[model samples]
Target chain A: MIIVAVLSIIFYLLSLYRGFLIYPGFLLQVAYMLIRGIQLERLPLVGPHDTLFFLSSSLVAFAIPFMFSINDERQFVGSVSVIASVFAIFSLLSRPHNIPLPPVLRTYWFELHVGLSFFSYALFGIAAVLGFLYIRNKDQETEILQYKAVLIGYCMFSLSMIFGGIWAYLAWGTYWLWTPKELWTTILWIFYSLYLHARLRKEWMGMPSVVLGIIGFAVTLFTYLGVSLLMKSSHTF
Target chain B: MLCPAYISVKINMFKKLLAFFFSLRTAIWLLLALLFMLLFGSLIMPARPEFSSLNSMPLFDWLGENKAGITWWLYGSILLLSLLTANTLLCSIESLIRKQQSKKWLLIISPQIIHIGFLFMLLAHLLSSTGSFRGNTVAYEGSALALPNNLAVAIKDITVELSPSGYVSDWAVNIEYLSDGKGIKEDYLKPNSPSFYKGLGIYLKDIRPYPVKTVLLEVSREPGAVWALIGGLLFMLGTVTLMILKIKKESSS
Candidate 1:
């Protein structure tokens, strides 16, 4: 865990320095132009504001898990969670200027449903790594990475469903669409539901649960990005 | 033994096929395939059902016919989901069912609840997509409308506007409600809030005070929606509770 964290930090820092060096041919230069009074809405990949948010977020996400391996840690995980949260907040704010949520969509229900949804996925993103780690190892009795992985993944699954139901009730007058995105999300929730159920029953172990965990995260990624990219969502900005 | 060698060969062949068709590897491939195809669809494919001859195509053309290439896409997606659901259910059925005898029936009941919630969600969305609702603002400080049903809403006044600092400072909506052609209840609504009437719920999504309040009241209704909400909440609570108890027990043991 510590090694992975350290490697991630090194890689993230490298990406940052690379960003600084390659300023002209990319979004940073445009952001620099924006800083000098250009419009923010007209930028491309890796916008200036987005770059900062990713750098800081990746650092926090990379660095926090190291402490868990260092000693019995207290709230280092919680702090990292806060960082992931702030990353989502910045991402929400960093929308392309062409499209923005309507004023009506900016209400408290929107924040609770959509905001919580993003943060939950960010957590699951971290958990996916832990799940993969568990799969690689031959052992499963320990309360190491598998527990943490399943815990966060299941947490995200639960919270997303809750918020989604509420959002659907308010926005479209219904909860589940079984659309590609919704279907994949439900599949993920089911996959993890099986994970938690097996864990509690002490029947499934090692390769099986780990594999499920990893795959659940894969579906989670699709639910997050693949569907949005492929289909026009009912909840589009 | 009688034909021991032949039996062994048959067993080996079955194992190979079983491993091939229904394993974690296939699930991963299925997932990646969904991502790959969806990416392809979004980037290159026409928005929806591109026609060879626009004038020739009928007004209500079949979704599959216009989109010649996407039927397989849709079919393939359903196939993928079926495989995944089968895979997980197969893996976890014994464990899940084994605990049905446990005193904490929550384990058994929770999944059932979640499944019900999922079904309701699917039904609700399908209903919303197919069914239609009409929404138009009744202008003026006091304008009332009589719909086909006895349901009527009188817009006493609506004012919404943002303050100088971009905060919604002055926003208010006054509405008169009626049921069965009789004036019943009236209330003032603001942003971030809503009110309900006879299964017809109205939300003050936003307001812009152009002297008279321009109220954006989002309205939606489906019979027994509250039941779906209740089911969802129960499922979440039950899953969370069951997970915690199981984890604590395992760690303690």
Candidate 2:
């Protein structure tokens, strides 16, 4: 597993010397995984190949954010975000179209549900670093970068949940199921709520907000991905 | 913040009620309740299996069979939802009435947008819970699958292959469907890919070919997608803009 992760990261980074890493590389990873699977003959749930695919795909896309200079990181992340978004559209494209349909991903609610949530997770990732920095360094040098990222993250996380709940409504017919995922998300949302409240109610600012911001984002990651691995939801793992 | 010395029982009752419905106390309680529930799901209990097929009983079904257990879960979640709804609604309303004069447009509008977005989401869930939105998948070359809630999917054709090693090499599917004879269409879906018609979508599940080849698909729909998107975009923009404006002002100063 460690080797696969390393390989995936390497391929993902190498693929970036030019553009478009996950898509073409994804096909190769899939093929390699299938061959490995045949040797194992039967491994359940954690298809190592598919896991590699997902890891590489996510990391490569996430790397774009850090790849840019301070001035250019936003554009770098933005451009890659646009390109990676194409895969989502392509998920709807089944040329001459002979791909077996997988469950857990078939519904519009599920798509938008998972899609918006992941975007929000990515958004949180961007926001989280700033919040972490704010909580760490109390100096003025990091203040501008700190605040900007938190703002972006807060906006994205809120939107993600609202949209995700709406999509859940479409799929599961419930706005909030209080599933482990839902529960943790609400906890995360509440942490943000407290930060907002502290800002207005007590004139709390600076590191306090950033501290909460950092905590909230860690919870947000759990809400999106960690929950699948560590918790349980009606939604697939 | 301060503690009042003493109060009459009646006033205290009112205060507690007010606190329960509007205070952070209620929100925390709701959040805690969900945490316990989630822990139950992950550690002690399991979420009910969503019944997509008749051959197996899902975990949800088994737990729900306890009758009282299902009721507890539902009521617990509702309690949380109600508290959340009240918090968001009242906060927004109070702001609109009390702070409208000094209100920052972004703050005022963003909260309203988010609150109403939550309400709409609740409303859509209400509509769907009653079983209004229903759908199924149909493979191009397979028979119709009878599903619950008066939904069915006809598989048009599902292609499957295995490499010499035996793991599945590829899976492809063509599907068709109709509901109330009005909403009907056909689509081709694959792994990580989905196709939609009449508000319903078909998603590829898994593919296997050994003794015989098979493809699986899951179908779904949601009536509140547009509202969610709208709320999400507005909220994101509002927060980011406000933060940026503050940062810029501070820098210039």
Candidate 3:
């Protein structure tokens, strides 16, 4: 698995120049996740290593569609490949421990919650990269793509939160908790909500909205990792 | 009729208030305020011991008892949320009234539906905060625990499957609900799978088989569960519809 991940990273880096090399990298990343899932007998999203890999894989997956659709495919594809490679490298650096899935994580709802959350994270990550590209090149098409990514990511994130709420209600008899992780998740959601509303105004369309998209992804990363690492929360894993 | 100037002034004030509530700018600022408040609360929660009581009881109850110095962010968040709710309601109302003549019904109504879903979710939290109940109790086989409303739960059996490495692989607790000392219903509770009886839910929190087979169960009554589910579904439906419509419009254009 490690060797496959290293090869995937190598291809992702090569794609920064060749652009088409991302396909092999993306396939290898998918294969890595598939193998991990089969070995774990569940969704391989329990720990940091698995989730980072999933995020990297999802970033490549989402970037593929945009690569074909957008005019500046090379620049966009190159940026995404670098970002996904960084995530993959981080996943490789993290120790992979195969522990038995706990009973609380045995439900389909939990799996959906984690899966959709990471997928949304990947979308938001791509949106941030696109936002950066737009700032650099000042392209209207890049801005539109960023908006579309944020819109789709927002819907998926909302669905993930709903599933999470249901799972919490079933397992803990409450739809919400006052823990730091939940609080940060809400913060991330509201930040994106602000970005969406700001996009409607004529004044916030160009630079301000793009900055919000970039900052919003930072919040997403904090909610996913910083909360678990810095605070006492149920998402410690 | 008394004074035209007074009436004009009053009407102007009302219009200002309406505009304040229905403006998108207000929504953006309110959401930003809420995000900051929540971020502050998240920071303070881990730093202060007083904030730890937040999960021990209902939010309203905790708010009344906890120190304001430590919980000011929560109070601020609640105020911001209240303002945001009003903003959502007024904005939806304004949109519907203004777009009444528009032919594109889905585009006109999708955002309003999302607002309604948000209102429902807030209501669910309100109901749960005031009416919900949660408590934990430990019991073993043949043990009967008394509950509210002349009800009781009797543990019938307990099973724990452990791996060779002494880790719990699976566990279940068989229980029966009793009314007037007569068994009314039988069910089993496992992790992530709670048994609902009437308005109460029983969850198997933990199990131990050291000296005697014992299980820790959490009994809770969430008055907002159904409302939350409804709200969640409505939110998802509205968002998906709006997203699809936007995508279609963009592609066609």
Best by TM-score: 3
Report how large a share of the reference interface contacts model 2 reproduces.
Answer: 0.17
Candidate 2 ranges beyond 4 A from true positions: A1-148, A158-186, A203-211, A217-237, B1-74, B102-104, B126-142, B145-154, B160-172, B176-204, B209-213, B217-253
- Could you tell me which residue pairs clash in candidate 1? B158-B213, B159-B213, B160-B208, B160-B209, B161-B209
Per-residue error (Å), model 2, residue A141: 8.1
Q: Give the per-residue lDDT digits (tens) of candidate 3, residues B154-237.
A: 999999988777878888888999999999999988888889988999988788988999888888888988999999999999
What clash pairs does model 3 have?
none
Give the Å shift of residue A171 in candidate 2.
10
What docking grade does candidate 3 earn? high
lDDT of 2 by residue, B127-224 (tens): 44443333334233556665445656677777776555554655667766655433277766654456666566556545555445565555555454
CA-lDDT, candidates in order:
0.51, 0.51, 0.89
Q: What does the lDDT read for residue B60 in candidate 3?
A: 88
Better of 2 and 3 by TM-score: 3
Query: What DockQ values do the models have?
Result: 0.15, 0.15, 0.85
**RMSDs, each prediction?**
10.5, 10.3, 1.3
TM-score ranking, best first = 3, 1, 2
Q: Which docking category, incorrect, acceptable, medium or high, applies to candidate 1? A: incorrect
